[model samples]
Target: MTTASLRALLSHLIDYAGLFPPAAVDLPTAIKNYQRDRATGDAWMLGAFVLPISRARDVPATLADTAASLPLSLLVGPDDLPPPDLQVVSVEAKTNDPAVVRQLVERWQPAMVFIELNPADEREVMWATLRELGAGAKIRTGGVTADAFPAPETVVNFIVRAADWRVPFKATAGLHHPIRAVHRLTYDIHSPQGVMHGFLNVFLAAAFAWHGMSPDNVERVLAEEDVANFQFTDAGVSWHCQTLTTEAIRAARREFCRSYGSCSFDEPRADLRALGLLR
Candidate 1:
């Protein structure tokens, strides 16, 4: 049975990205996987489908087999606005300056916008701008190479700062596992392996950060690779010395850390099941 804390922490946590690399599936395959996955008990953990804004028009013609309104988080670029026909809930794009974000949103706005930032170089000003614009932040946690993974310090900083700024955030890439450990980076048999960040670690750390935990403790939560380090009860979640109530987790999920994207929904779900977090 999933605990109340687990449900609060994990509800709608994964935004599916079957169209992206390593799992670079076709539109029909992605749609089919999404539909099939939603039919299972695990659907509670599912979120939006990630697609390029340019492909917004194709969603309709290809979605004839499925039910209506597949929520989409468009991977956007260069003045691209989603067409009126699609259910474009949010858009994700890279930007260092808030002015660029403001200008883009002024042209056409989605319900949510996540702007990726270089937390190291961009100071508090960047996050302040996001807060002012009523938008969220985005972080790229990993890629195909070992170097693609940012140091743990970078991720922790992003989480804490986003919390401090009262900005919601989402993560993409390299967070397909439930725990942080050395894993193959790609689907190919001989794929290069690296220590990837776990989605649980990242999101739970965000929850604590949102609740005003110290940065050192937040990093501790992120760095923990042992499943034993975490204890989820019906009332709260315990990580070492700190614990957050289910209500705290729900508030964080609603306001601070929204969701993350993964190329395979099944992999994360299966990992959660193996850990006995799901039944």
Candidate 2:
């Protein structure tokens, strides 16, 4: 990906503020929306499935057949074993036993393995089991979804762990907008607890974990509080400079919705606000 392309795509992966339909929209419609707003870039566009395992098991044969026809990378719940044409399978770490997990990996060999980093006991076992699976088998990553309460520090530590293990993973939930800001309104606990801020998380992950940057140095970048600072070109040059937190990113999303009338990448910068949806 070119520097500009990488920066542009990362912006979308970080926020995902563009799609503004009511929550009750059907899956097909959501998929269509994504199709309409599709961005043409080398950076991967990770798509998600809202269906639970049982329901997904009954996916229309036509949908399954059409899945491989789609452009972006698709992800279905672990519980739901959609056809391989559907792309990645994100099995909930808790729902499946290790043997089951192992079987799924051996059977599908998906692009990624998503686990929810939970209680100390489970977390330890899950981490080790995943490590045993080894690299090139599948990309392994964890997250704290809306249904669970995970300390942000632990979440950050987990990212560090993944990096240490050379695991290239992405996250979702609570990260709705990106950034370390507090939601004083006590929004729906059913939703994921997003990062305190996108700028901080990206800077921390890149500087400290991915690039071996020091904490102090990352803190300095956070002091400036710019997402753009962390977004560098494939060539390592700066393009489309701007910094953003989860809140600011959300605010930007509101603006984007007003301007574009819908959430697709129809509006490039506006669409980028949805980057946080990566998780």
Candidate 3:
């Protein structure tokens, strides 16, 4: 694909989740960093600032002087409600029950509702409910250990299911780099290390699945660790023998895999540059 196409595919793909996990900075620090990212040249790649619903009230006061407003994605519970002025673009709720999801959606009336489901939950029922409600899904792709990373098959299944059901979804946790590799789980020097999913791997798989790629192919794409097998062009990205057109990728990005939350935006940017995908 052309550079323009690649840019379009990735536009606003990473939701800033600085308040979560390894980077867990204070609200003030997270706000400062988000503001800096918004002011940078690559700001177009940044999405909403994510924070807990309980902390929503603190955001306006904390960022009062620094940023005029923030596009937010609140991590909310089933009954939590964001303040009217929070400017929430989307909401992530931790619930496997469709009834609770329905209630939250009816009350908050967000642009998007990302409901997290248990791995063993009746996924079909949950996805069907989301489809009926016109909501979305959220997946936790990684955590602090090797065991935290879901199997490649699990992720691929989620993508295929969402594509089949036409349920848009977003991912959070452990996707800080552009490619899959063993990396430190946290910023601390003594932090544990594990194999983390690549943002590229997950999203590209979603695109391919959205275009009807077979489950095996999607799994291969997710497991791809060799950068040489993947090619980036002005028109679109190619993995091994499979190629996704720019238009297809853009459509998948828009309608299927919305975005992933990351604690550190700089890490993904740096990895992209090192791979020569960025200047």
Instruction: List, residue by residue over 4-74, the lDDT tens digit for candidate 2.
Output: 42433344343232222213345566556554545444224334433334444455666765444543223
Residue 102 displacement in candidate 2 (angstroms)? 2.0
Candidate 2, superposed: residue stretches over 4 Å from native: 1-24, 39-51, 57-65, 71-85, 88-92, 95-97, 122-125, 135-151, 182-196, 203-207, 214-234, 237-279
Question: By lDDT, who's the top model here?
Answer: 1
How many residue pairs clash (N, CA or C atoms closer than 3 angstroms) in each of the candidate models, in the order given? Answer: 0, 35, 7
By lDDT, the better pick of 1 and 3 is: 1
Predicted structure 3: lDDT? 0.86
Off by over 4 Å in 1: 59-68
lDDT of 2 at 2: 31
List the lowest-lDDT window of 10 residues for candidate 1.
59-68
Q: What does candidate 3's lDDT look like per residue over 153-246, in tens digits?
A: 8898888888999999999999999888989988878888988899989998899999999999999999999877778787778887899888
User: Measured by TM-score, how close is model 3 to the native structure?
Assistant: 0.95
TM-scores of all candidate predictions against the true structure: 0.96, 0.56, 0.95
TM-score of 2: 0.56
Q: Which ranges of candidate 3 are over 4 A from the true structure?
A: 60-62, 65-68
Local error of candidate 1 at 77, Å? 1.8
